[model samples]
Target: MEQATLQTPLGMATILGDRNGIRAIRVTDHSEGEDSIPPALAEACGQLREYFNGERTVFDLPLAPEGTDFQQTVWQALLGIPYGKTISYMDLAKQLGDPAAIRAVAAANGKNPLWIVIPCHRVIGSDGSLTGYAGGIHRKKWLLNHESANPQQSLF
Candidate 1:
């Protein structure tokens, strides 16, 4: 596994990846040292910078998130969410064909590791309020605002 951290307007983000793909991207309070950047980490950082600069929409990188089968299914479902769109947890549950699993869907969403790439920030409360995000609600709002301001030209 390789790791690198970058400071963004929202906060410091730590990205972990391997030759297979990016595994995780999470916000952390600590800043990483210059020497800590691996070659793959540099590529990931560059992509993230491009994203923040509004030059990139979809990410082109490998992703290998570690999670259970159900968690992986939920995270994969998140990839279907459009860049500027938002979905309720209940909606996601229904999409999964399990309306009774709203809490389970929310739990799986909370466990998503690939943050922006998976687009977990697109999930919101049924009442249209921003809900829990591991990265922080402020960052979640920032991501949503960013996407809304710079809508993607093409989803694919």
Candidate 2:
């Protein structure tokens, strides 16, 4: 696996991947030792740059995040959420055919490793409040607002 850290409006963005596919995209406060920019991560970096620049609303990169089957299912559902749209945990669970799975779905959403690519930031609390995000709620809000300001028609 190789990695690269990029500068974004929120902070440093790190992408980890290999020939298999991208494994994760982590946001952090620093990028000291993360400057290598391996060839395998180039496509992901370019897509992310387009996303942050509001030129790309939909991502078309291969993802290989390590997680349980249930987590993978939740993450895939998250990908279905349109850019600039939000969904409650309950809604997501219901879409999964089990409204009682709200907690579980939210847990998996929190564990999403692909950051903006997986779009875990698009999930919000039932009452419309921003909730737990690995990248911080402030960053979540920023991402949501960013997508909102640049809404695109849903292809689904």
| Candidate with maximal TM-score | 2
lDDT, model 1 = 0.86
TM-score of 1: 0.89
Name the weakest run of 10 consecutive residues (lDDT summed) in model 1.
Answer: 28-37
Q: What is the C-alpha RMSD of each candidate to the true structure, in Å?
A: 5.1, 5.1
- TM-score, every prediction: 0.89, 0.92
Stretches of candidate 1 off by over 4 Å are: 32-36, 150-156
Please give, for residues 57-80, the per-residue lDDT of candidate 2 as tens digits. 999998899999999999999999
Per-candidate total of colliding backbone pairs: 2, 0
